[model samples]
Target: MPIGKLYGIGVGPGDPELLTVKAARLIDETDIIFAPQSKSGKPSVALNIVQDYVDKRDIPCEIYQPLFPMTEDKEELQRSWDEATDVLYEKLEQGKSAVFVTLGDPTVFSTFSYISSRLQNKGVEVELVPGITSFTACAARAGVQLTEQDDIMVVVPQVSEKLTKILPYVDTVVAMKTSRHLDVLEDCINQDPRQKDIVSVQNCTMDDENIVHGFVDNKKYFSTSIIKFRK
Candidate 1:
């Protein structure tokens, strides 16, 4: 049996055309394609983004839908992840090259982290294909500069309290994973009195992309906000 390998491929944001050249090439060459969905029997946004580049002509595809349990059930989440890992392990054991598609860069807040960590522990050969992050996409769409000469930029995810303490010192801040914590984040930013240059970009690089500058009351499900201190 040929040795199987795992490829952690990032599909970038929602745009299919934004896929990295390497990522697109690997999708066409990999023997099998795997994408994880939030729930069972659901379509994967990551797969959908790169469907055009992926040569599904005769490749077998596996949709591993791990339960995205929102509750704080650590045990249940681990169980689901383990079961999902088993499915991947089965494919890997067959000596077939499997591509695990993830949104954004695989190394940054991507689900591939957990799977890759476990696979590495088991001595599975793995390769990573990095893609563009939503933060850069949002910045481009909003026409904002993330950094200037000798300036520091911090990328955070919905940790408003921690950000509240650090925002005063940073020149640029990009906040992600901001659906439920939108209100709190807004409150924290507004309280600083230097948040006049705040801008929010939601569903970046997609058709329904929304960009709001200054103050916004109603927040969407998936969004990112850039807080720039120009004072």
Candidate 2:
């Protein structure tokens, strides 16, 4: 029997229209859908993004959201990954192709990349299809270009000294997962004369999405900041 292929499909940030034509087609044709949820039974954001594109009338597809927890504990993370891999492996063994929906481009801070590597090691053929990233979407929506001319751009997933070090040398800084380290980020950017250029966008392109002009004490979980420097 022929084996099935696994596609790590990037579902973009949130809006359904941002989905690539290829990503939409695969969702419609795949035998099963895999989405990464923060908890065991929570709905996956990536899965929701492609709902309009999936067709189940003639060909019904199963949707499975395996838990990919948000934690710093290594043992817990490994266990979650292992469990998710086992589920995918089972589908592959049944000759059922799958679409693993991801929030942004699969290569950048996406759990799909780690899971895809595991599936490959298990001998399952995997393909990655790119989609729009959140930063670019936020920039376009806010009318703020990420970079221009010879402007330097940096994308950081978390708060760290690296961001501070680069503050003096870049034109744009996109800080993801910024809620926890708001203080560190605030102090660094506060030192810059271009502090007014910073803006935090929560939920990017989603219907309930919001864009704040500057730093705030409370921020939503799915927030990221775009800071434009003087070039």
Maximum-TM-score candidate: 2
**Candidate 1 Cα deviation (angstroms), residue 67:** 4.3
Question: What is candidate 1's TM-score against the reference?
Answer: 0.91
Clashes of each: 0, 0
- Candidate 1: segments with Cα more than 4 A from true spot: 55-71, 215-219
**Residue 115, candidate 1: alpha-carbon lDDT:** 83
> Which ten contiguous residues of candidate 2 have the minimum total lDDT?
51-60
Candidate 1 lDDT tens digits, 118-231: 887877889998888989988888999889898878998766567878778888878886776777877777677663588888888889988988644555656888888875
Residue 4 of model 2: what lDDT? 88
